[model samples]
Target: MNKRLLKLAVTSALTVAFAVPAFANPFSDVPAKHWAYDAVNKLAQAGVVTGYEDGTFKGDKTVSRYEMASIVAAAMQKDLNSDQKETVDQLSKEFATELNSMGIKVEAIDKKVDNMVKISGDARVRYGASDSYDNTDFRARVSFDGKINDNLKFNARLTSDNMNYDDEFATKTGIKLDTANVSFDALGLTNTVGRQDLVLGNGFLHDSAMTGIASEIGNLKLFAGHLKDSNEVYGAEYGMKLGAADITADYVKYDTATNDVDVYGANVGIKLTNSVTALGEFYNVDQGNTDANAAAYGLKFNKLGLTALYRDVEDGANSAYSGMHNDIQTLKDEDGYKGLEVRYDRALAKNTTLNLKYQDFEKQDGTEIDGGARTQAAINVKF
Candidate 1:
C-alpha cells in the first residue's frame, strides 16, 4: 500500500479502537481477521474514536486532512511513542487553523487566546409578603473580570434595583456600583484593594462589600476599609479546615465617636453525613454601655437543597451590631427576639434558580405588627 493509504488505515484504526463505545466493535465493515483489527480494537478500548452512528468504519477509505487532525487531537492526550508523536505533530500542523477553530488547543496560539477578558451578569425578580404588607422587586447586575498579567487581575460589577412595584410610576428604582477591585499576589501574601465583597464567619453576621484593602496571611485574612459615613474600619478573619468540619472566627471593629466598638464572631460547620450538614454561629458586639449577641444553629440538607434554622438575639438586637436593621426593633420592649427560618433553593434550569424562604419573629419595623411572619420567593437568572 502507498504511504498515505497505510497512514490513513493505521490512524483510522487507532482512533476507532480507542475512542468508540464499549458495548461492541462499532464498525461492521472491519472484520476481526483484518490486519488493522487489533489496532482498532485497542483504540476502541481506550475511548479515542467513535464510529459513525450507523456503526460503520470504512477501513479501505481515505480520510481528509481535517478528519486526520481531529483523530490526532484525540490521540494527542494519549501516551504515544516518539514516532507516533511526530506523526501527530505533523498532522496537527497541517490542520492547525481547523483544530483551533474547533476549540482544540493548538499550542502555538494558546497563549494568545488566554489574554482575552470575560463578562457575566445576573437578574432577579422577588416577591415578599407578610400579614401586614406585600411587595415585589427587581434587580440586575453585570460584572467584568480580566487578568492583567500573571500577577494581577481586575474585577468590577454594576447593580440596579427597582423596589416595590405598586405601579410603573410609583416604583422606586436606583443604580449602584457594587464592586470595583483589583487583586494581586506578592511577598508571600494575596492582596486586594478597592470595593470588594467581604464576608466574615459563615456570613451570619456580616456579608457586605467595603472600600478598603484586604490581605491574606496563611489561614488568616485582614481587611480595613471605610464604609458609609463611618471612619476607618478593620477586621481579621481566620478559618481552619479540620477533616469533615470547618471552623471560622472573626474580629471586626468600627471607628466612631462614642460608638467605637469591637465585633467578634465564630461559626462551625460539620458534615454529619454524605448529604447532611450541621452549622452553629455566635456573634457579639459591645457599643458604649450596651452589649448585644446573636446566635444561630441550623441543619442543611445538601441533596434536597433545604435548610432549617433558629436564631436568637439577647440584650440588644439594634442596628449597632446587626446589619438587618429594618427587621429588628430600635429598642427592646422585652429582652430580645427569637425566630425560626426555613429556606429552600433549587435549580429550575441552566443558569436559573428558584428560592423560597419563610421566617417569623417578634414584630419588627418591617413586618406587620399583628404577627411578625414573612414569606418570600425569588427567581434568579444568569448570563
Candidate 2:
C-alpha cells in the first residue's frame, strides 16, 4: 500500500483509539490465524486505519497530540459539505483569539490545505528554568469548537510536543478528546454538562472532573462528576457547597470505567471586606489500604487597583485532561506545590494602563511534577 494510505490508516485508527469509550474492532490485513488480528483490519478495510511496512500493526501503540491533530484534520477534510464549511470558518476565528494568549499572531497561522472547519492551532516554544533542568519544550495544538445550539456546544482539542528526549518515549506523541456539552443560564440557574471544567477554592481546588457543575444558588454551586485518581484510576465526585463551606466525596471504580478512584474533600471560603478573601481545600482519596490525604489553600486581596493571591497544594485529586492541577494531586508523583501570585493594574491614562503579574512555584519534591508557576505582565490599550 502507498505510504500516504498507510499514514491515513494510522490516523483513522487513532480516532477509535481516543474515543471516550474505546471500541476495539477485530480484523486484519493478515489472515485471522494471526493472534493480534482485529480493529485495525476493519479500520483499514473501511479505509480508516493502516498497517506497518513489516505487515504488522501495533494496535496498542499510543498516538501523540500532534499526530492526532493531523489525523483529525485529514478525517474531517474527507467531507466537504457546506455545513462543515461554515463550521470551519467560525472555528478559525475563535482559535485565533485563544492562541493570542500565548503571543501567537492570527496572521502567522499556516493552515494546511484540504483544511476543514476553522483550522486553528498554536505553537509555543517555551523555555523554563527549574531545579530539575533548564530546558525547552515546544507545544503545538490544533482544535475546533462547533456550536450545536445557543446553549449547546461541541469541542475537540489536540496538542503535542515537537521532540521527545524526555521520559524515554514512554508516553504517546499526542493527545485528543471529543467533548459534546451543553451550557446555559435560565430560570436563575446556570447548568452545564457533557465534558466540562471545574474550579474550587480560587484554584486551591481545581477539578476538571468533567462530570458536571451547576450554579444553583447565589455564590454557591453543586457538582458531581468523574475524575481520575492516582496516576491511572477513574473516580467520581459527589459534592455540595453553601457559601464558604463545601464538602465532596469520590467513588473510584474498582471493576470498571466511570469511577475507580475515590476522593472526599471540603473547603471553606471567606471574603474579607471588599478586597480580601481566603479559601482552603482538603481532599482524601480512598484506595483501600493506600488512602491518600491532601490539602490546598489560597488568599486573595484586591482593592484600589491591586490584586494578590497565595496558593498552595497538598496531596489532592489528579485530573490530567487539562495540564492544570485540578485537584491537590499533581499528575506526577512525589509532588507538592506552593506558590504566590500578585497582579496589579494601574490606569496610567484614560483607557490605557499597565498590568503586572509575578508568580513562583517550588515543589516539595525535586521534579517538574510539582507544577511550575507563571509570572507575566502586559500593557493594554482600549479603542
Candidate 3:
C-alpha cells in the first residue's frame, strides 16, 4: 500500500529472478534478514533492485557479465547529463551488437566505456557446492580504438578470463585480443574487415560466422571465412541489400574426424517501414552427396517505442538426428537437431527490460525423441 511496503514486496520477488550463469545470491550488505542496507536499500528504494523472500541483497557475490550490465544500468538510469548520455548510448550499441552476434541478448551499457580507451576488469572468487575452499579468478583488458588517419581507423582489445580456470592458467598470462575493427575506402567502394558481426537475413546466421571480411560492391555484401573445427568454420557468407529488403547467402564447410560436411544457405529479409521487419531463409547440407533442406523465418515489431520479435525454423529431416541431418550416422534419419523457437522482449524502462524465450524441438516417444523444451526469462539493463 505504501512506497516502503511496495519496495519490500518486489524485493522479495526479485530474489527468484534468474540472473543467468549466476546463482541466486543474497547481497552481502543486506544479509538474510536485515531490513536496511546501503546497496540494496538504494536499489530497492529506486525500483532498480530487490531481494528474495528470505530478504537478502546478496551484493558481495560474484555476478555474470550480463547481470552486471543490468545492475550498472539500473544505477545510472534517470541520468540526464548531456555528455554522459551520448557516451552511454555508444557503449550500449557496441555491447548489444557484440552479445547479439553471439546469439545472446544483453542491454548494451555504452555509457560505462565510451570513446576513451577503457581499462576495466573484474575478479571472481567462487565457493563450489559443498566445497570448503574458494576458487578465485581474475581477468583484465585494455582496449583502444580511434581514428589514426583521415580515412583509416583501427581498434584493439585484450582480455583474459581466468588463469586458474585455464589449466593453462599461471602458466600463461597476457593480453588476448577480444575485438578489433578497421575500415577503408579505396577507389570507390568501402571495405571493412576484422573480428566483428555481420547482420544479414535478420541474423538467422546472426553471429553464425565469426571471423569474416565484409566487402561491398554496389548492392552486394560479401562475407568470407574463419570456420574450421575446434576453432571455427572457415568459408564465405555473401549478401545483397535491396530497398528495405536484403538477401544474403553463405557456404560453410567442416571436416571432422567422423565425417566431411558442407553447409550452404541463403536468407532474405525486409524492413517494412520503421515498426515491422521480416525474414525468410533456405538452407541445405551436402554430405556424401546427399542433400537436406531447412527453412527459417523471423519477424520484428518496433512500433509504439516497443520491440517484439518471433522466429521459427522448419528444418527438414536429416539422416537421423532429432534436430540435425547426420548423413554420416549409421542409422539414417537418426541424428539431426530440429526445433521450434519463440522469444519475447519488452522494455520496462529506457534502460532496463525483460526477456522471455521458449524452444521446442521434434522428439520421438517416451524419452524425448530428440530435443524437448527450453524456457528462460531474464531482466537486462545497460548503463
Candidate 4:
C-alpha cells in the first residue's frame, strides 16, 4: 500500500467518526460532499465555531492551539452524545496544557472585572420653613471608590443639590462634583490630595469643601487649602480621648483680600451617662482690628435620640460663625442673633432615618426676632 493512500484512508476514517447529522449549510466553502462537512456543520449549529464572516469555512486552514482551546471551551457548554463526548475528551487531553492555561486566563479576566470596580449612592429629601417662608429640596450623591493597588485609592462623588422651586415658583437644579481625591499612606501619615470636604472642630468653625492637601498623624490633622471662595487657608486640628470625654481643637489662618484673619476653636463631648452626653464648643475669628467670637453648648439624650443646643454669639456683629442663622450684613455691624436649636433623630428602617428640628432665635436684648422660628424635617436613605 502506498504511504500517501494510507494517510488519506486514516484521515477519511477519522472524519467519518466525528460526523453528525446534516444541518443547514452556513458556509459556501464546505459542501455536502466535503469530508469534515458534517462535523463543521454540527459545531456551527451548536454555536461552537463561527467561520469567517465572508461566508467561508476555510476548512483546510490550520488552527492555533489557543484558538482550538476556545472552541473546546464553547463545546464544553453544549449537550453532547457519548460518541461526541468521547471525541471531545480525547481532543481535550491532547490540548490539556493549552486548555488549562486558557482556563487560568479566563479566570484572571473575570477576577479583574469583578474586583476592580465598585459603586454606591445615597439620597436625601428635606422640607423646611422659617416663619412666613417655606422651601423644599432634594439631593442625591453617588460615590466611586476604586482601589488602584495596595497603597493608593481614588475616590469621587457626584452630587445633585437643591433641585427645587425658588422664591418665584420656578424650579432650579444644581449639579457638581462634591469630592474628588486620591488618598495614600506615606511617611507615617495618611495623605489626601485634591478637592475635598472638611469638617473641623466639631463643625463649629469649618464644615465645607475646598481644594488642597490634607495629612493626618495620630489624632492630629493638618490642611492647607482655598477656604470656601473666601481666602486661602492653613489649619491644624488635634483630637484627644480623655476618659469619658472627647476633646478637639483647631486653628486656621485665612489670607483675605484686605488682611489676614486667624480662626481658632475647640469642641468637647463628655459622656456623663450611658445614655446622656454633654457637648460644648467655642470659636473665635480675629482680624487685626477686631474679633468675632461664639460659643455653643448642648446635651444629647441618646435613649430618646433628642438633642438640645444653645448658641451665644458674643460679637453679635462681624462674626465668622454665621452658620446658625446669622445675617452677614447685620453680623458685621448690628447685633447678631442668638438661637436655641432642638433636633430629634429616629431610625425608620434598616437604611433609612428621619430627622426633625426646631430653632428659636432672639436678639441680645432678650427680645424675640420677628419670624425667627424655624422648623425642618428630613429623610435620609442609604445602604
Q: What is the TM-score of each candidate against the true structure?
A: 0.66, 0.40, 0.48, 0.65
RMSD of 1: 16.5
Backbone collisions counted per model: 11, 26, 35, 2
| Tens digits of per-residue lDDT for model 1, 1-383 | 25434433543453344334423422344454544444443443333333443223555554454554555555565544344456556656667887876666565765676566667889876666665556656678999888888889899998884544555633345677889999999888899999988777756677666899999988999999987556667999998878877899988898886568778889998978645789898888787787888888999875566899897777554333344432212222435666787989755433456677787766333343343577766776776
Candidate 2 stretches with Cα past 4 Å from truth are 1-125, 140-143, 148-152, 160-260, 303-331, 335-383
Please report the candidate that would top TM-score against the real structure: 1
Rank all candidate structures by their TM-score, best first, as comma-separated numbers: 1, 4, 3, 2
lDDT of 4 by residue, 170-263 (tens): 3445567889999999999999999888878666577677789999999999999886666788999999888878899989888888888888
Cα lDDT listed for each candidate: 0.66, 0.43, 0.47, 0.66
* Better model by TM-score: candidate 2 vs candidate 4: 4
The residue ranges of model 4 lying beyond 4 angstroms of the native Cα positions read 1-115, 166-171, 316-335
How well is each residue in 1-383 modelled by candidate 3, as lDDT tens digits?
A: 25434433443354244233234333334343333234444444323343343333554544444443454343345432243345444444544654444343343543343444434333222111111212223445456665556677676666664444325676677657756678777767577777755444444433432455667666555655453224334456666667767777776565556666676778876867534567677667676756666666666553322233332323332412112211111113334434555666544543445555455544332234322454434444432
Candidate 3 wrong stretches, greater than 4 Å: 1-144, 158-176, 187-189, 198-200, 206-212, 228-244, 251-262, 270-276, 304-334, 364-371
Question: Which 10-residue span in candidate 1 carries the lowest summed lDDT?
Answer: 325-334
lDDT over C-alpha atoms for residue 91 of model 1: 58
